[model samples]
Structures are given as C-alpha cells and as structure tokens.
Target: MKLSTKELTESLRELILKGEFTSGEHMREIALAERFQVSRTPIRVALAANAKDGLLKYSRNRGYSVRSFDKRDIIDAFEMRSMLEGVASRVAAEQGMRLDAEQQARRACDVNDSLLLQNCEIDEASIEIWREQNQLFHSAILNQSGNRFMHEMMRIVQQIPAVYPPIIAPYRLQDLRLYNAQHRKILDCIIKRQGMRAEALMREHITGAGDIFCEAKPN
Candidate 1:
C-alpha cells in the first residue's frame, strides 16, 4: 500500500512509542521500507519528521536511532508536561468556559470511566477505546485553553514517547483506573470553577504517570 509522509510518520511514531523500537535502536531505511511495505523515500521523510519532534536522534555516521532517555530525562520531560498541562487547565477554567466544551469533556470522561471501572480483565481492544477517550479528554482541555502557543508546544511534547505512558507501555487495569480517577478529579475542579485546584491537580496527575513510567521496564 502507498503511504504518504504524514501517514508514514504516524505509523512510525506508533511503532516507536509502543516499544517496538527500543531506545537507541537504529532504524535502517531499507528494513523499515520493507516492514511498512513502502519505499525508502517515505521512510526517510517519516524519520526526519520524528527527529524534528525530538523522538529520534540523528548522526552523520549512524543515520537515525531511537532517542534514549535516562531517569533524569524522563523526570525533566514530565516536569515540563506538568507545567504546561497545569497552565492549560487553569486557562480553560479561567477564560475558556463553554457549555459545549464541558459537555464534550464530560462525555469523554464518562466513556473512559465506564471502560476502566469494570472488574473484568482489560483487553487490547478495550484499552484502545479508552486511549482514544483519554486523548479526547486531554485535547478538550488544551483546546479550551485559548492559547495557541501553549497548545502547539504541548502537541510537540505529547509526541515524545516517554511523556505518553499509555502508548509507550501497556498499562495494567488497576493503573488505568487510577489514572482515570485523576482525570475525573481534574474535571471536577474545572466544573466547579476552581482554577488553582484544577491546575494543581493536573500537574500532580501527570507527574504521577511519570513515576509509573520510571518504574516500568525500560524500552
């Protein structure tokens, strides 16, 4: 099948974030071209795009390798994410309130809760649905922030594999429940018009994920 640069980039991003490519693993153009059933040109374009996003490292001799992060690097990434997400939540509560935005966020949270609150084992299929809902919830808050610069920078930050735990590692059901609980708390502050609490909770919520990622098996 033919894959455009955008499609190939997304595909490669998913593979890297899912730990298919271990940290510091070299991405051979010919090998990736065969894996994605595309040509080297598109693979090159995809790798270049990911490098721009800071997900991959480039060197003249080695070409492209998946970027590696140590414990400190992970902490720093979360530190930045926490601040940015907190600001977004605060701004949303302060100036971007709208009935429709609230409704969308509520629906996303409800969907995620329904999936995560269950007692049954979490399968890959359900996990995928929950991931989409989680993204929706986060995106709603960012979109309502009314700061284009923050939104764009946060977009780039989210692309970093370590900053996105769910995509980077398969999470336990219990972990999913805990994360969703935090999401609800953040939403609660937003609904109650408590900007400071919402901001603080969002910061705490994201840092908690960073802790979990640190404990998880290194990719």
Candidate 2:
C-alpha cells in the first residue's frame, strides 16, 4: 500500500513528537524515503510541509534538521500564545453569540471533563486523550476569533516542543491528573462566557505548564 503525503507527514510528526528524532538531527530526503518505503517526492513534500509548520528548520546546504527548543523558547512561545488566545476568547465573548465553533469548543471541553470523571487511574492513554481534547478546545476558540493570522500563528506556536503531550514521555500519573484539572478550570471559565476570566485562566494555564516543564528540565 502506498502512503499518502498526509500519512507520511503525520507519521514523521509523531516520531518527532515522541522524540524519536533528537533536536538538531539532520534529516536526509533519500534516507527518509528508504525508511518509509516511499518515493522521494512524497518525502520531500512531507519535509517541506513540516518545515513550514515549524517542526523542522531548513538551511541552504544543510537540508532539514529538527528544530531544537530550549526553556526560553518555550516560555516565550507560551507568552505569545496566551495573549493571542486570550484575544480570541475576548472576541468570541464580545460577539455575544454562540456559534457552531463555540459549541465545538464546549464539546471538546466536555470530553476532557468526562475523562477526568473516570477517576480510576491515569496513564499514557489518558494523557493522550487529554492532549487531544485540550488542543481541540483551544483551537475552537482561536478559529472562532475569526482572525486568520492569529489562528495560523497559534498553529505554528503549538508545533513547538513541549506544547503537545505537555510533560516528558515518562510522566507521572499525579502530574497528569493535575494538568487535566487545570484544563477543566479553563474550560469552565469559557463555558460561563467569562471572557476576561477565561483569558486569564488560559494565560496562567499555558505559562504554568511552561514553568513546570522548565523546572523539570524535560529537554
């Protein structure tokens, strides 16, 4: 079976997210083509797309290398994300109307809430669910902001290391629980149409994660 460009790209993205490829590791088109058993064309397309997404950086003669993000970069990225996302929330609230996008955001929040209600035990699987729902909730608001530039900016910011799947691979159950709770709080604020509160909560939510990740020295 042949892999589509999207499939190849997503596979490579997961590998990158899982730290299968270390920071600054050079990627060769021919090597990836052989590894994925695909032609160089699709490999090239995947690489180019990922590069534009901020997962990889390109140089004139250096081909492509996984971008390395440090503590400072993560902190800075979250700072910007908070402001942009806050603006989105405010815009949604000021509009005084709940559109399909707002409902989608609520749905994502509900998913997270349901997962937390499980209360049995948290594990890698639970963490994956939380990450997906968390992103969906945030993306919902950003999309509703009706600001293409801000939405695109957040997408690029999210591609940074440590933004998705939050903690390091070997995360503790307690930490995961705590993170989920924080997400719930942010969602609560948004659902109540407390725009200012939601914005503040979101800023704290993102920056707090950055702080914890920095403290733990995940990278």
Candidate 3:
C-alpha cells in the first residue's frame, strides 16, 4: 500500500534502526520503494527527511546512504541528550508546569510504578512496554518546558542516531531497579519544584546509563 510521507518516514526509520540495512548501504529510492511496497515518491520524501535527521547521508550524485555511528558518536549523542533533557526538566520546574502536562507525566510515572510493582522481567515485550511508557514521561517534561527550541532539539537527538536508551536496546542493559529509582528521583525533584536538582538528576540518569550502553558497544 502507498504510505504518506510521515508514515513512510517512520516505517523506514524503524527499519533502519532494526538493522535492515548495513552501515553505508545506499538506500536507492527504487529499491526502498520495492522493499516497503510503496512508490518512489514517498520513498524520496522519507529519505530526504531521514537525511535531515542525520540517519542518512545525502549527496548531489550519490543519493542516500545510512550513516554509521561510532562510539564517540554515541557518547556525544547522550551528552547532548542529557543536557537537553536536563534543561527541559529545569525549565519545567522553574516556569511552573502546566496542569495537564503535570498530570500526564504523573500518569506515566504511575504506569511505571505499577509495572515495577508487578516485578516485571527484562524481556523483549517488557522492553517495548517500558519504552512507550518512558517516552510519555519524558515527552511530558519536554512539552512542559515551554520552550519550542528545546522541543525541536529533543526531536533531533532522538532522530539523529539510533538511541538505545536505558530500557531500550542498551549496549549493556542497566538494572531496571536502579534505572527506575533514578526515574523516581527525577520525578520527585520535579514535583517538589526543585529546578536545579531535577536538572542534575536528569543529567546524571542519562549519562550514567549511557556509560553502560557505550561500554558494551564494540569499538
């Protein structure tokens, strides 16, 4: 079926992240169209968007190829992500969070608390569940930051590279208890309106998990 530009973009991005294409593999429009069961039009649009996301390289003559990320690249991504997310947390606290945003984030935390209370295991399905719930929590903070630029930068961070977050495809997975504890600490600080503490906790949480992810990745 023919997909819209946004649909094709998400489909192709997930495919790439799932390792369907090797690093530097040329994403020929015709080939991708065939693979995705679409046409060249959507493929072209999606590829362009992926290129802008830094997940693909585009050149005048060569078309698009998947960009390979190195250890340093991953490190840099987490560094930037931590700083950005920390800033978001701080902004949300200092500016006074919107009521709805606060409610949504609390809901996300509640979901996590329920899961952990049930003694969830580290399985594939559990990973997917955490990813979805955790994003809701983080997205709420980003939205409440009340800064359009920060929201845009966050998108860039998630899209620019394969983000193997703490509960996701971490290179070396962290203990869920520790990870969840950090999450709780962040939420606590935010709820308490401790702006700087929230910021520091967020930065520490991201960077600490990143260290595990990177150390497990091949050099």
Which runs in model 1 stand beyond 4 Å of their true positions?
Answer: 161-171, 217-219
Superposed model 3: Cα runs more than 4 Å off: 59-62, 117-120, 160-174
Per TM-score, the best of the predicted structures is: 1
> RMSD to native for every prediction?
2.6, 3.1, 2.7
Q: Write the per-residue lDDT of candidate 1 for residues 55-125, one digit (tens) a residue.
A: 89999999999887766676777788899999889988877567888888889888978876775787778
Q: Per-residue lDDT of 92-143 in model 3, one digit per residue for the tens?
A: 8888778898788778777766776675456667666666787888898888
The model with the greater TM-score, 1 or 2, is 1
Give the per-residue lDDT of model 2 (tens digit) for 1-219.
878999999998877776677788999888899999999999989998889888899998999999888877877787888788777776766664356776776677677678867756766687778778877777777777778888788777766745333445534556656666766676566666788887887777777765766666555
- On the 0 to 100 scale, the lDDT of residue 209 in model 1 is 82
Specify the poorest-scoring 10-residue window by lDDT in model 3. 163-172
Error of 1 at 190 (Å): 1.4
**Candidate No. with top lDDT:** 1
Cα shift from native, residue 40, model 3 (Å): 1.1
Candidate 3 residue pairs in backbone clash:
none
> How well does candidate 3 match the true structure in TM-score terms?
0.86
